[model samples]
Target: MYQLTFFLEEFLAQYWQKKPTIIKGGFKHFVDPISPDELAGLAMEEEVDSRYIAKKDDQWEVQHGPLTFDNTPEDNWSFIVQAANHWHEGAAQLVTPFRQLPGWLFDDLMISYSTPSGGVGPHIDQYDVFIVQGSGKRHWRVGEKRDDYEEEFRHSALRQIKGFEPIIDEVLETGDILYIPPGFPHDGYSVETSMSFSVGFRSPKKQELLSTFADFVISNDIGDVHYHNPLLSTRSCNGAISEQDYHDLETMMRSLLDNPHLLKQWMGEHLSQNRHELDIVPSDPEWSNEETYQCLMNGDSFNRISGLRAFYHDAQPEIIFINGGQYTLPDECADTAKQFCNEQVVTAKSLGNAIHHPAVLTLLTQLINLGYWYLVE
Candidate 1:
């Protein structure tokens, strides 16, 4: 487990979503969780999201990988592997401290290994991130939030901005954390061979939320309504959209918003949806309820699948959503279900009487067999 240097409540009240803050030695005696070689190996895997960005001959180049380093250059390049938590256990542990915050908002752990002078260039990110310097050092420059900026599209996939004054510029060493809020323009250049692990949080944009909601309504065959006015009013101009038209449309849109149940269900599923490939492997031979109970009694522990999204709403306490699906817990096991949602790891002792209950045992077996949770010694 990793410990945060500052009080989480203080940080949330002062800096979270408001401004950037640098915490020196966030983790005491920090060690690099994932090696550069391991990161490179992950980048070579087809399912992993990886990218290589470099400056070659005064021209910036970007390569989407499943990359092999056979012909790769030695310096001025970086390899970024996304969702390392899903693939590597050590990398996954990096998220432990940040889990003190809301779990549902977590994105993933992205680890990047860069050679000297390597960087992705100055760009604005739309989500919150805590960049932890894992090994070696990196000079990071973060500019204040800007309302006006012009892009210098160096590459089709990369949008970089130039001519911004930096507010925070420093070389971060091992264990140092730089918390960057959404819309903060920041960039980092490797001072030497280095690794940086970013624990990111998700904040959906208005456009994205609207698009997803539109899709949800369409998929569910709802939100279709025709305009109807009991008393038809004449408009001065035929070309102009009248106030009645605007009112009717606004009412139509409000119908969806007014349905709190539908909205909650949609939002739960949307937030639970996995953004990256999951590392799920169903049990080879499924366990029966008796076997699961026996294992629990024998001091077996349960571990949540890395990067799995599991959460419940207070209004709908019985239903727990995980990976875009919903499961309702029996009234007797509601406490245990809530515990599962709140924790990443569970021990038999923590469960107490719930482990022996039939419904809870069956649910545990199913979850374990489904690869969402696994029994561990």
Candidate 2:
């Protein structure tokens, strides 16, 4: 088991969201969690989401590869493989160290390789990412993510930066990690054959925010938010809209968006909950004291995913929340679970030792059977 160092805890507590950080050689016994071959295999599967982008001479180019790279040429190119960790358990372990951060805060794991002079060009991302340098060296130039749009060689759909000034410009080596916050512009190209692991977190898009807020509004069934203003008679010089009415419309829209309750739901769904939870469906539902007893007799362990997101309510730190549901545990169990929630993995024995309670054991059993909990035999 990897022990949480004082520095890791301190960094997360202080600069995680407030600022950026770069931790050199943070992982030891270090291995490339998954290789390019494995990523290619997963890409071949139709159900998976994968994409690749390349940087060539004075141009940023992209090619969609679902296993074959026939479209790609041989020189001065970078190859990006995305979400490798999502499909492969081995790759997922590399992410285990960052479990202290909430799962919702994570967007995806992207792996990339840049041959000499290959890079993504200078660009900014509107998200937070930890760029873990795996093998070889890469020179990085980063700047603050700006709102201005810069037209370049990019997908027509994407809004990207034109250019920016560097705030942190340096070369990254094996095991080194560079942290970039949202709105910060950064670019990296290879000094050699370099590999990088990017763990990202993103704010929900407008569509996502609006749709979720609408649901929140609906959930508040008793609220009097119905739009009801008597229509005025047509009395206009140009039959055009008046500034006051326009302002009123804008105000109403803002009011709906500004509602505290609505904001909370948006946060809960996209940030507080796990992205993987939507894909999960508990297997066995029927449980009894007898069944629980049998599991104990057989020494059967609970099933838990190493990536499961567990946390306590920010305000009510007493209430434990996981997979979009809330449950309260005994004081000891709550504290213990909180520790496990923020950790990569924990055993049933460890859990039992932490919180000696039948109910807690039962919950673990349910989670295990549901495949949300994992137990080592």
Candidate 3:
């Protein structure tokens, strides 16, 4: 297992979302969990979100995968595979150390393999990221957050800035980590044939939240109350919306936001969804509740599938969300639900007597059948 040499609390308090910093030798004597060849293989898959970027003749070119390296560029090219953790178990372990942050904020583990002088160009990301240097070395330049930086499209799909005065510039060796927060302009190029693993975290924007909440409301028929105004004064102009009319309409909309239960439900469903496709394969022959329970009691453990989002709010501990679906637990099984959400592996011993409860056993069976969790072989 990989471990960070730096103190997480000090890092979070001093540098998180405030500025960019390089933690030298973050993982002492680091060993790459996934190799360049394995990353390339993942990029070849249709379900994977990968990109090939190259610059030739001072012009940038971008290709969206599934890619083939039949006519590969000799240099000045990079191959990036997004959400590698969703499909690769070894790659998924890279995110375990960073679980100190909110799990819902995590986006994915994006792995990139770059040849000498290969880079995606200077760009700004709207999400936080920790770029962990693997084998070989990379030169990274990070600029402070600035709203005045102009964005230019080098390629149709690539948005890059012309250049920025770098605040933090260094060449990172193996095991070094660079932490960059959202809105920071940064660029990195491989000093040699190198692999970099980026663990990204992002929170929902207001627009996204509003749109998703609206959809949830429509789907569940939760906020169908029509606007009502009992006393309406005659208006001088029909086109003019009165102050009282605006107030009443605003209140009507605000009523939905005021409901704590509605907000919690929306948050649980929204945050539990994985932005990338999960590698889920349901059991061919579904295990019955009794069989699943018997297996668990017999020392079998269930491992949660990589990139499956599972979480429960502290305010509503009885309700847990998994992959956009919410399940309410029995009072006696609340701790079990919390364990399933917090831990990647579930064992009969870990669950204690909760595994014996018929309701809990049934839920576990259902989840396993749905492919969210699988028996460890």
Candidate 4:
């Protein structure tokens, strides 16, 4: 694992949601997390979120895929296929070890698979992303964030610039990372058969908040607290419950949100868990320590858990909601706790600790069985 302290000396102070910063080979001996073929196979699955945009005769056409390349377009087009890591186990593993960057730094790890002549066109992204060059070469045209930025062509899920502008335009070799902050208009084209890992961080917009709030209400046992017009007792025939009724409804909703107990807990659960579920296919549960094993171990080598965190509050808590589920730990189990909150790793010690709570064990077994975690010998 790449140590944070080592990078701290040169760490970009304003990295989290700030301007773009590219650190070449930031993770030493960094290899492409997943292969192009693996990513391509993932794009075929329907349950996983995936999208593709390719230029068609100077026009951009976007499509959902389990797609195969047609003619290996020679020019004037590129394709971006997103959320590859979410759908495929092999790909998701690439992202799992990088949990040091908190899930919030990742909207999802989208693998852009393109043909030599392919490109997604110039576009502005509202989210931050690290474009890691994988196999082959890609020519990138990126401009620093500008107030004049506006997308010229917009298809569903695809945004393109009206004209090309480049503050930094160049070719990226395999293993190079190009960081782009939100609001920057950029484009990428494959110089040869190419792929890019777009590690995106898409924060919830205000509308998403209202949406999740409704989901929060539905998921949790929020007893139906309707608008109760206490004023009906007054028998005011003068109007249909007055603007005061609206006020009362607002107050009721506000109170529910303001509920110190439930709101706080719900937010914790929601933020801890991801909106999308990780396809945690498990491997058979085996703890027989081999060389990759220790007779007894502390969290290390993907086991000694460190650097678990929550992003919204920049908050760290003992427990977290992950992979659409809640996993709890005592405040003392900080490392394991951080592991659960920050990643999908299921540690043996953590499992052993929850032995009394058989339910936790059962869930852990399923996760292990699903290949989500194993002793990282």
Residue-level lDDT of model 4, residues 183-226, one tens digit each, is: 87787788888877776777768887678778888777685766
- The candidate scoring highest on lDDT is 3
Clashes of each: 0, 9, 0, 18
Query: By TM-score, highest first, what's the ranking?
Result: 3, 1, 4, 2
Per-residue CA lDDT of model 2 for 1-377, tens digit only, reads 22222366777677665666667666654567767666667766665555556655555566565646676666567666666665677767677666666566676777886677777666667787888887788898877545774756465433456677787888988777888887677778888887788878776788976676666567766345655558755664767778867887788778876776555444554455655322244556655545555555467654445445565555444455566555566665765556545655554445556434676666655665666654445
Candidate 3 structure, TM-score to reference: 0.98
lDDT of 3 at 96: 96
Model 4 scores a C-alpha lDDT of: 0.60
Considering every candidate listed, which one attains the maximal TM-score?
3
Clash pairs, candidate 1, are: none
Residues 1-377, model 1: lDDT tens digits: 67777788998999999999889998788899878888889999999999999987768988897987767677889989999999999889889888788887899999989999998988998899999998999999988898897788788878888747889999999999999999889989999999999999988888988899999999988966677788887777989878778988898898898998888888888888989998898987998989888777788888989988988888776677888887777877788888878888777888888877887887778888899998787
Q: Which has the better lDDT: candidate 1, or candidate 4?
A: 1
For residue 151, model 1's alpha carbon misses the true position, in angstroms, by 0.8
* Residue 57 Cα positional deviation in candidate 3, in Å, after optimal superposition: 2.2
Off by over 4 Å in 2: 1-6, 9-23, 55-65, 79-83, 102-104, 144-149, 157-159, 203-211, 219-270, 275-300, 314-319, 326-340, 343-346, 353-362
Q: Which ranking of candidates, highest lDDT first? A: 3, 1, 2, 4
Q: Point out the higher-scoring one by lDDT: 2 or 4.
A: 2
lDDT of 4 at 84: 62
lDDT (Cα, 0-100) at 6 in candidate 1: 76
Minimum summed lDDT over a 10-residue window in model 1 is located at 311-320
